[model samples]
Target: MRIRFKLDGQDVEVDVKHTDTLLKVLKDRIGVGSVHFGCGEGSCGACMVLINGRLRYSCLTLAGYVDGKEVTTVAALARDGELTEIQRAFLENDAAQCGYCTPGMILTAKVLLEKNPSPSDEELFDALAGNLCRCTGYIPIINAIKSVSRR
Candidate 1:
C-alpha cells in the first residue's frame, strides 16, 4: 500500500508492503542513512525515531503506522546544517563510540531534555534504557545528555 508521512521535515509518499517495517522503508525506500538497524527486534534503539515528538522503535513499527504522521530524525534537529546543542554535547563528551547508536541516542536525548529540562541522572538512565551502546558504555552517553540538560 502507498503511505504518506512527513520524514525529517519534508512530506514523503512511498509504497510499502504489509510486512515492511518503518526502518526498512526509511533506509531502503527513503534512503535515510542515519537511522541504523541493530537488533531489528526493538531490543536495541538503533532504529528509534521521534514520531510526533514521541520516541518509537521503527523496527517494530509498521511502515503504514507512520502514514500521515510526522517523523523526526537526527538530520532534522540540526535545522540548516548547523549542529544542535545536543549534537554538540554528544560530540564534546565523545558519546558516539561506533556511531551506530548515535542517531537514536541523540534523538531520544533531545526528547528527554525537551520534556524535562532538569532531569535527574536516574531519569537519564531510565530514559535511555532501551538504547544499548556496547562500544562507549553508558557513562559518556549519560554525561552528554546531562551536559545538555538544565540540571
Candidate 2:
C-alpha cells in the first residue's frame, strides 16, 4: 500500500506492505536511524514514536496505521542542529550509555513535560516506566528529565 504521513515535520510517502511494521518502514525503508528495534513484542520502548502527538511503539504499529498521522521522533526534537532543552539535559547529566534507548527516553520525557511542565516525582517516574533503559541505572536519565523540568 502507498502511504503518506508527516515525519519530523517532513512529508513522507512510501509504499509499504501491510505486513511491514512501522519500525521497519521508518528505519529500513525511510532511512530513519534513530528509531531502534529492540523487543519486537512492544515490551521495550526502543521503537516508540509520537503518532499524531501520542506515543506509539513503531514495532507494533502497522505502517498503514500512520498513513495520515504526524510522527515525531528524537530527530524532530532538535532544530537547525541545536538540541532541545531535554536533549541538552541528557547530555549534561550523562544520561546515555549505549544510546540505544536515548531516543525513546527523550521522546517520553518530551511528552511528559509537554503535558505537565511541572510533573512530580511520581508522575515523572510513571511516565518513564514504559521506557526501559538497561544502562545508566536510570538515575542520570531521571535527572536529565528533571533538569529541564519546570517543577
Tens digit of lDDT per residue, candidate 2, span 33-83?
Answer: 889999988887999999998988999999999998999988888889999
Which predicted model would earn the best lDDT? 2
User: What lDDT score goes with residue 10 in model 2?
Assistant: 94
Clashes in each model (backbone N, CA, C under 3 Å)?
Answer: 0, 0
lDDT of 1 by residue, 1-151 (tens): 9999998889999989999999999988888987999999999899999999899999999999999999988888886788999999998998886899899999889888888999987888889989988795688888888888895
Minimal lDDT window, size 10, model 2: 128-137
Mark the regions of model 1 whose C-alpha exceeds 4 Å error after superposition: none
Cα-based TM-score, every candidate: 0.96, 0.95
Clashes of 2: 0
Reference-based lDDT, residue 105, model 2: 93
Model 2: residue 132 alpha-carbon error in angstroms? 0.9
- Kindly provide the TM-score of model 1 when superposed on the true structure, using C-alpha atoms: 0.96
lDDT values of the candidates?
0.90, 0.92
